[model samples]
Target: MIPMPARIIAVCNQKGGVGKTTLVTGLAEVYTQMMGKKVLVIDADPQYNTTSALGLSGPEFTLNDVLYGDESNNQKIFPGVAADAVLEVGEDWQSPNHSELGLIASERNLASRERDSMMAREHRLRIALKGVAEEYDIVLIDCPPSLGLLTVNALTAATHALLVSEPRVASVEGLAEIVTTIAEVQENLNEDIDIVGVVVNKVRKGRKDQDVWIEKIRTDFGELVLDPLLPDRELFAKAQAAAKPLKSFGSEAKVLRADLEQLARAIWKGSEA
Candidate 1:
């Protein structure tokens, strides 16, 4: 059996096009495949890209059902309702290991819940996953690219936060805002939530501006910046496109896979720098 009270990590970025969704699915895959953890991915984002990348298509019970309850069954946020929404991934891919991966998928309708004026809106996701989270060793929340209610709900539920950014001025600039948001969440919502590290993703080697931005990120964030920078690779897109494991791409995917595995290790170990 997996450990009780899973380490829930909210993979967040306030800016779009920074590959936040990609990192979520990649880390989920790593946690399950390399580290042998029972993983549950909560696609809190409305776009639901992470849901699709995980090979789940048109799931009937999604995060929407978990948050607002499945009206068809007249089920509200009761104990284990979130578990009811979870579906196993990679059954079609025929990988026994991938079978361990579970997901509370997302759909476009999830976006509307953010504007929900109901009381205790930020606590919805937390309430839904109470008993369900303990079934997995790791729970990764794929937050939307905005510091909105959805992101706040993810923060309110998470035990840790992993900030992902590209080596660009615009992307790096948004990091401060997200950091501030996390701080706010700690002050008001979930005080136990901590930032594990900052992942500088999609680095283009030898690009002058990117080099400068990466340095700035390290200088500003200090030991919080995790190492083995993720380079801009087509393999990430390819593997995600096929809904296949990164290692399945063969020899060409070795280095990137190793990097991801190492990164996953660092995150799970709660290492800094």
Candidate 2:
């Protein structure tokens, strides 16, 4: 029997530094390790932070290569396990669980390839991902912090989107931009695409202002906002610096691990809804 096709989810927000990469990387780890689902991570950002965080060196073939077929001779270049592979969510992998996370590693050259023909934009990522859809249960795309071609490609390819925002004034203001972009994409590009829900990240615990914004977002968006917020934790920064996921940060990561697990379940169930 054939495997079910993966659910492609784009973790997107127009604002930068809102923990988009962190959520994508960590969720991918949890989905695979805890839930036993195979996962693929697409680093659509040219910065390749997700690529490096996952311990993959700059690969010759990025989404650009697959988009333009520029490196047609190197289409098979998937992420390979590196020595520094970090996250340890399961007993199966003693080293970092890089192998468990399928990454289409990016490089600096990806920036130049963004200028490809407009017609090529719609199906670039979808076409590339089609070949590997059977390998994983889910594909989480780490979109760039802008609504450019890279983001357009992600939106077009995804079945749904996970919007990440912080409990900040600026991040709240940026939510409108994200909603507008998603609307435009659904109208003009991919009709099947939907906003899965908004994820509130980096939330400050017991902050009055944070509570106010959270309620405002929920009231405005209704059920589009998910429950169980990701708190602002120093461990998140430490995990980034250590090149590991929150789940691998040892005992300090327990609460975070539980939260992410709940988040994963929400994602799975939301997809069904």
Candidate 3:
């Protein structure tokens, strides 16, 4: 019997430093370690922060190969070589209790793809992942902090999108750009693409500005804003800097772990529905 296709989700934000890559890895870790689900992370961002945070280094084949293909050899192209580029960060490898995690790594060369003179580039990502994405229960794409070709490809490929933002004026303002981009993608690209919700990330305590913005977002977007907001904790950065999951921190990471698990569960429930 063949496996069902993964629910591809793009974790997107048009504003830089909104923790979009962090959320992508957090959700992937939750789905894998906490829920025992097979997960794949596509590092669509040219920065390749997700690939680095997951403790993968010097990946021979990256998302660049998948997107542009091995044109030098005339051997592989879109949809055919996607599987060839995937690498596994296995259980108990970087962090404890981790299940096998699939990764289509990214490199700085991917930034060039944005300027490539190619037709139908927006659909290339979707075409590449066609059969390869089915091996996992979920595929999370870490989109760049811009509404450029790479992001367009990610949105085009995703079945759903989770908008990430910090409760700041700039980040909040940038949400409209991404939301409008999603709307345009729905209108012109993938009609099936729907926004899962907005993730309020990096909320700091005692910041009245953060509070005001959170309230404003809730008023504006309603229930689309997910609850139990992610706090601006040093542990999140520490874990990423250490190139490990929160589980590696043991009890010290309990609170952030719970928050991530809760949001992951919400996403899981919605995806299943």
Say which candidate scores most in TM-score: 3
lDDT accuracy of residue 51 in candidate 3? 89
Q: Top lDDT: which candidate number?
A: 3
Global lDDT for candidate 2? 0.76
* lDDT (tens digit, per residue) of candidate 3 on 1-273: 988867888999899999987888888888887888888899999998998998888898898878886577552455746778888763433334545688899999999989866767788889888888888889999999999999999999998999888999999988989999999999999999988888999999999989999998898788878877999989999988888888888999898889999999887766663
What do the candidate models score in CA lDDT, each in turn?
0.85, 0.76, 0.86
Instruction: Give the Å shift of residue 107 in candidate 2.
Output: 1.8
TM-score of each: 0.93, 0.86, 0.94
* TM-score ranking from best candidate downward: 3, 1, 2
> Which is the better candidate, 2 or 3, if ranked by lDDT?
3
Clashes of 3: 0
- Candidate 1's C-alpha runs over 4 A off are 1-3, 70-76, 92-99, 271-273
What lDDT score goes with residue 62 in model 1? 90
Write one digit per residue (lDDT tens) for candidate 1, span 229-252: 999998889877888777677899
Error of 3 at 69 (Å): 2.0
